[model samples]
Target: MFIDSDIKEFVEALSSKEPVPGGGGAAALAGALGNALVSMVGNLTVGKEKYKDVEPEVIEILKKAKELQEKLLSLIDEDAQVFSKVAAAYKMPKNTEEEKAKKQEALNQALKDACKVPVEIMEYSLEAIKLQRRLAEIGSNLAISDVGVGALLLKAAVLSGKLNVYINLNSITDKEFVEETKERIEKISEDAEKLADEAYQIILQKLKIEK
Candidate 1:
């Protein structure tokens, strides 16, 4: 696993012609930012005089959001590393029949692993969007904008994850595996869009409308 410093170097690599920190890495970062925004809303609601009755629940939400954020941040590196592995597998020598079969198997497995990571990212980001919607309804009035921000970030994550899934699907040779992944990604993307739209409407209704 890459450390924080390594992640910085990875981002610099992204700035060049590198492909590892492409869509997959960007999706992970979007998910992390979404989770972090949800944590911010939770923190803002906790220990406040008006929100005292819900303070305990806010604390729990804050803890969970923080944990998810940390996990998503780490996934940024994980996604890049897995992508690099897939690239390496593709580059393996295959002059002999046995070596060709072995390299193909390795490439297939690497592609699967790469696909799974982005799927996990999409799932986690959808969960974060759900949390943002809930918080927008009951969170501190002043912090509703943060909930909106969370929703937006999750939307970005969902779209970014979809891009990674599509790219990986092009490399996958298994029909069943590709079909299953496509179905799952479609469902999650639809749900994420709905959640983000609802969050946007709620925030506008709550904070932007003139009383």
Candidate 2:
């Protein structure tokens, strides 16, 4: 699995011509990194005397962030698997009229399946961003900069996931599916962008950095 591979191995694979560890996998990784940062801040704050007042909330944030981090990491491999199905569908036989019809049907299904992982990546990244926003407000001051970096990573994940969705949507012929998926992506992207920026700005203000 891509997740089991070391960073050097994964980067080597990603740099190669092979398509599985492409944008979808990269986006999932970015989201996972962002949530890991959230958990880091929570961990540093959880047992500190100064932060004891908010320890309960920090513990809850740690739980959610860890869950999201694991889910996003798993999606890195799931994205590759679904995309392989799409690649295989493209290689389907299309010599005869019947063969062409069968190939098209298989391709359409594969395209839809390929979209599922990226959509989940976008949705999960948005949730992670929400956690970062809250963490920025109450997380450890010493680790506040990590919150800014985390929010930025989550935003990148959301945008990257949207692009991956659009690329597959371009080849999909189902009008209803294309329209609905586009709507969903648009909404997720809008809210994610706004919330991520808010989280970053809060961090900037707390650090006394000029906007």
Candidate 3:
């Protein structure tokens, strides 16, 4: 698993010619790192004299942020696995009509699975960005920049996930499925952009206040 490797090893593996740890895995990893930062900001905010007023909320944010970090990290492998399945499906033999039908069926299902994995990743990224928005509002001023950085990372992850979704959707023969997935992707992409920008601006404003 990519997660089992050390940082240098993971980078080397990702840099290799293998396609398993491609854009999907990278996006999930980025989102995981982003949410970790959000958790750190919440942790930094929750136990301080100056931040007492927001401590309760920060504690809740910290709890959820930890959960999200793990969930996004898990997606890294899931994304790669599903994509691999799709790749394998494409390589299946299709010399005969029966074989062609079987291959088509497998490819359709694999593409759907591949699309779904990235959709889940985008969902997680949205959640991380929302947490970051809350952190920018109530997190400790000392680490507010972390919240901004995390929010940006989450947004980038969402966009990356969207790319994977679109590519899969284009190959899917089910128009209904493609349309449905596209709708969700568009909404998440729009909202993620809005929330990320708002959260980042809040972080910057907080830094100015601190000055």
Better of 2 and 3 by lDDT: 2
- Tens-place lDDT per residue, model 2, 122-152, is 9999999999999999899999999999999
Give the TM-score ranking, best first.
2, 3, 1
Compose the digit string of candidate 3's lDDT tens values, residues 90-175: 99999999999999999999999999878988999999899899888888888988998999999999999999999988888989
- Top TM-score hit: 2
The residue pairs found clashing in candidate 2 are none
Q: lDDT tens digits, residues 57-110, model 1? A: 778778778777877888888898898889899899999999999998898889
Listed in order, each prediction's TM-score against the native is 0.90, 0.98, 0.96
Model 1: CA > 4 A from native: 1-3, 6-11, 209-211
Which ranges in model 2 have alpha carbons more than 4 Å from their true place? none
Question: In order, what lDDT does every prediction score?
Answer: 0.86, 0.94, 0.89
